[model samples]
Target: MSNNVPTGAEFKEQLRAGAPKMGLFLNSHSPTVAEQLAHSGYDWLLVDTQHGPMDHEKLSNMLCAIASGGAKSMVRVAGYHDRGGIQQALDLGADGVLVPYINTAEEARQAVSCTRYPTAGTRSVYFPQRSMNKAGLLGYAGNANKNVIVALQVETAACIENMAEIAAVPGVDMLFLGQNDLCMSMGLYEKYEFPHMYTSPELQAATETLISEARKNNVILGLFLFGTTRVAEFLAKGFSFISVGNDLHHVLTQSAAYVQDLEKIAATEGKLWTRRPTALF
Candidate 1:
């Protein structure tokens, strides 16, 4: 990594300054894909461990690949309470963590604690680890507490009710709104169609509450917008940390579209062939 690349601390400072940072969620478990996207100008890349198929070895390789491109890397651990998983990600050189299902202030605090060392928190230390190698032993140990970001996911009705307290929790850097899960938790998923989910009065009110609380607490507001269509609208509404979409979604969508276009051209040329099933293997 180049020395000129901004550190995670600097990235957090950017968020504090209200600069919008766009990122991509990496679920393909391919270091080549990760490195490619990292170099493609995203501010950051998140390795999805919760729903993605990556184990510890794959996660470490992905983080290393992300670093080579100078983009900050974060890991979405399997659960809010997965302390060991959180430690592993940071140990493997992740810039921070995005914890899911953090519904209360205490849960947020626990998530933050897992990123720090003793006195500040209870994260266990391992010498000569990837983080130590990247940041230097003493430098990483002494400053990891301040540099490591702790972003909590607010995806439930309980989280919305405790938004103020959760936002005010010490060491909480960013609060990410998980839109689909929030809508499902609030019963708006079944009540509204896909297009209506974002505009539904109930979801909008909750989003407003989160924005207000984040501003009041001086924390960065984040969201998983799914794609680029609504990014401008949300950024204007006060979300600085936003993920446009994931790797798998982009690959699938673009590939399918290309194939469809080819089929249409073939049909127009009277060269279209009948579809046939292929062996799975």
Candidate 2:
């Protein structure tokens, strides 16, 4: 009778305290990878269903795998207006949900509604699933709507324009911007370095706008980060959440750099294994 439920208390605590929480996107869709990350000490893990290959079945497996980890489980459902995945994710025990392309207050409200049941929202109940522990279904319904975090992505110009309105949405817990897509929207297609990419006028303006709106509404602001390089900078500006990178990205980036460095040393010494390899991981 092991039941996995999403208690959004931690996310709420950090959001209110203004302390930063580093989340990672689980794009691998492998339960083993998800289990490995559970031990990595991340604050949260997002199963990227939007751009990744996690169907409902795999997403459910991931949610269960990540439950044992220290990080909270979140699902980035496929479409902005998808109640199917939203309801499915909530039912599968996601701590929160990240709805993409939230361009207006209405979409934000709908996203929140899908997470709730009849009287409060449009989420239908087919419980006794993994989230209920087969025991707490009645009690779970009582507090889920308020406890489950609902983070909306403000990625487009329309969303930025309606930032104030979106922030005012009752059930919307956090606001995030994927900087890469955001830059593409603003036509700033240059490959800027990490931390420095956020310094551009367009990105800076977007950050300022989110900051202002967040202050007025008491909402949390989020950004996508490559690593810990710019954490202090964004945290100083009142951001509470950041995704450090996906599982695949982390392993590949570190391993590739390690290999390249080894090649450099080998070239200088005229031997491939002249010395012991430095432990990068």
Best-matching candidate per lDDT: 1
lDDT of 1 by residue, 249-280 (tens): 87866766676787788899999653344242
Residue pairs in candidate 2 whose N, alpha carbon or C atoms collide under 3 angstroms: none
Off by over 4 Å in 2: 1-6, 190-197, 272-281
Model 2 lDDT tens row, 210-249: 8899788888888777777878888899888888888888
Residue pairs with backbone overlap in model 1? none
Each model's C-alpha lDDT? 0.89, 0.81
TM value for model 1 = 0.94
Error of model 2, residue 219, in angstroms: 1.0
